[model samples]
Target: MKRRIAILGATGSVGRSTLDLVERSPARFEVVALTARGNVEGLADAAMRTGAKLAVIADEARYDELRDRLEGSGCRAAAGAEGLVEAASGDADWVMAAIVGCAGLVPTMAAIEAGKTVALANKEALVTAGALMMDAAARSGATLLPVDSEHNAIFQCLAGSRREDVSRLVLTASGGPFLGSSLEQMSEATPDQAVAHPRWSMGAKISVDSATLMNKGLELIEAHHLFALPSERIDVVVHPQSVVHSLVEFVDGSMLAQLGSADMRIPIAYTLAWPERMATPSQRLSLTEIGRLDFEAPDLERFPALRLAREALERGEGAAIVLNGANEIAVQAFLEGRIGFCDISRTVERALGEIDASRPRSVEEVVALDGETRDRTSALIAESRP
Candidate 1:
């Protein structure tokens, strides 16, 4: 039988990659539902192309537009948070949680609560509410497959290995666009320059996160939750090549790494065909042609976001939520030219300093803390303006 699928954030980069794979292997999967934040055109188009049974728009105001767009496509339309949750919890054997930032938390939780095999592309879902979500997944028996290339690499490397024998997980980073730039250059960097990731094709916000190295930090938090490893055991390294996605070091001194060309489809395909492998059109790695792979320690002096993320992970879940929330606000400000590129980490640092680091015991508390952090961070940004 074909795997029934629901893709949240179906218009985004990772979601599009998934759609590409599913579209290519029509007999292997059935698109049950498709959702997007506000891209009704993209959502409707994907739904129609896949013959998805349902399409959802997260913006309630766009319901009419979405519904009208899907009128004759044999796909029903819904809107707002309820619509998103409905799409997630509907009859889908697998769900791709690709909605970006904190916005993904609810729908992602819905999928987990429904006990679907979830391909997690949104790091913020875990970064902001790791413990709670993990607990929910455990209670619901939901299988979470990491979709971030680094986390997926670690996941693949750890397969069939005894967890107790694992020494550490090393997550690779592309070091982003500012890897070689001086502090002064970063301070004056433009949004266009910041989002110009050399290796990956991604959405704007994630591209900015990569540029700031906050993406890796957030991944560190995610790895902690996904792998059940402590902050100290997980390390980040700047790998400009982006060939070796990540590595897992065993206690006996052996290291296993998952290498692939810089393609999101490779990992997405892995999750889609879990317990069984599937072929993808991703470019195969040619080690001879790409002769060298260089690795360096991340420069905390230049990218303090990584440090802030690790500190937040050590503090507890509440702090992690705050760190992610604050960084999201700050990244948007930087993208909008309201703040200097360097101010992104500074804003996160300020918020972390002022916010209470108490652990959130429930999803409600996590959402509340995230909201409070975003509000406080925004006000702090305003205070520092001019």
Candidate 2:
């Protein structure tokens, strides 16, 4: 019997990489469902190729197009947020919670509630709704596997170890494209320059996050949840090589690190075959060819987002939700040229300061808080507009 799978963001980079692996070892896995936000063509093509039982588009307006494209494929087609939730909650043993932002929070929670193992790639889901979702997973017995390379590295390093014996987790960063650039240089940086990441190929928003080192900060909050560690226990280092994905230091004066090629597929494959390794076509790591690896402390002055993230995590009172929501708006604004690139962190900081982050007891409240923060951040952007 093959392992049944439903990839929520099946048209994304991670989704495509996962599909690549599944396609090669077709007999090991069964594609149960595939979903995309608005890429009807990509979703339809994937469904047709995989022979999935269902395909969903989160954008309701694109439903007819998706349906038409998937017409003769015999796979069921649906649209809207409800459609996404249905696909996530549908019959499948594993669901890839890779949908972009807080939009993924609900469906991810649905999968967790249904007790389906979830391969989580959306850091915002945990950033915005950590407590609520983690609690839900505990109640439902859902296994939330980490797919982010950094978190996945820590996960692999700590395997079979006593959590109580683990001292701290060290998450490595590539320092993005602006590793040595000054704050002045960064302020004048263009979106194209910002998104030109040195190591990983990613979507625009994440690429910007990486450029600002905000990506590593968000990962810190996520590690707090995933590893049950506090902000003080999680650390970050600027590793330009991206070879050392992450490191874990034990209480017994020892450390373990997971190094691999700077490929998203490595971690995706890790989560796919979790607790058991699987063969992947990902490029193997060659320490000899790579030669030396460099590491340094993140420059908080150049990238204040990382500092802001730590402060938010330390507060632990729904600040992560506000940070994520504000960052999303600011990053998009930056990408659109509505705000200067450096203003992204400034906007998030202002929003965090102005917004009252009360602890959310439920997912509904978390979503509501996220919306409120986005609105406030938008207002700030408008006020800053010339």
Candidate 3:
């Protein structure tokens, strides 16, 4: 039997990798739906090539262009938030939620509500509404598979072990491009330099988060939700080699780790063939060729975003939501040259302090609070500008 698949952010790095694997093993999978934010060309091409039943464009203004592009492709076209929800909740058995930022929250929730097996690449969904999303998964009997390399590694390590025997999870970070740079150098870092990740190729927003070590922090919150753990039980270490994806320690002093080449397809393939392993075109790991593996503690003073994320995780869901919302805006500002690289964490810190930390009981409330935080953070940025 073939597994039905849907990709929410088909134009992204992870999404493209998934499509590559699916394209290679055509007999094992079928792409039922494909969506992109505004890349009509890529979306249309993927939809047509995969023979997907539906192609959705999240940007309503590009609906006509998308529709025209898919006119003779035998794939139906839809646009905007409603279309994204439709794509997520369709007949696909495996849905890849890879849309960046808070915009992915609703559709991701929709997939969970529909009881679909979700490959979650969108960290914001778990970061902002961990409790709510987990509760929905529990109620609907939906399986939430972590696609981030760190969380996926932890998931694999705990596969045959008892959850009670686990002591802590160690998530490894590449430390981005500024791993060794001083605080002064980081503050003066350019957007290009920040996005120039030494290990992996990624989109701009995620690259910035990696540069500031906030990506690791967001994964910490995500691990808490996925693994039923607390902030204190999780640890972050700087592993410049990117070989050891993550580690899990047991109460008996036994530590298990998942090591692999720096490839998104490895994790994507794991989720795609759950309870079964699939072959991917990822590079094979050679410890001999790449001799020494180094590790160190993350310098909080140099990258305060990780510290801020840890603080937010300890404070609860509301603080996490504010942290993610504020960071998203700040990262965008830095990318557009409206703010400095170091100012990204500074902006998130200020928003966390100023925003009401009241916990949202529902998804609607979460969206409202996220919007409010983004607005306040934007104004705060504007006010600070000369």
**lDDT, candidate 2, residue 47?**
94
Span of ten consecutive residues with least summed lDDT in model 3:
65-74
Model 3 spans > 4 angstroms off: none
Predicted candidate 3 versus true structure: per-residue lDDT over 299-376, tens digit per residue: 999889999999999999999999999999999999999999999999999999999878899999999999999999
Candidate 2 root-mean-square deviation in Å: 0.8
How well does each candidate superpose onto the true structure, as a TM-score? 0.99, 0.99, 0.99
Q: For model 2, where is the 10-residue window of minimal lDDT?
A: 128-137
Q: Candidate 3's error at 250, in angstroms?
A: 0.5
Tens digits of per-residue lDDT, candidate 2, 180-279, equal 8988898899999998998899888899999998999999999998888888889999999999999999999899999999899899988888778899
Alpha-carbon deviation at 343 in model 3, angstroms: 0.4
Arrange candidates by TM-score, descending: 3, 1, 2
Error of 3 at 241 (Å): 0.4
Candidate 1 C-alpha lDDT tens digits along 1-386: 99999999999999999999999999999999999988989999999999999999999999999989888889999999998999999999899999999999999999999999999999998998888889999999999999999999999998998999999999999999999999999999999999999999999999999999999999999999999999999999999999999999999999999999999999999999997889999898899999999999999999999999999899888889999999999999998899999999999999999998688887788889989998999999999999
lDDT of 2 at 216: 94
User: lDDT of all the models against the reference?
Assistant: 0.94, 0.91, 0.96
Model 2 lDDT, full chain set: 0.91
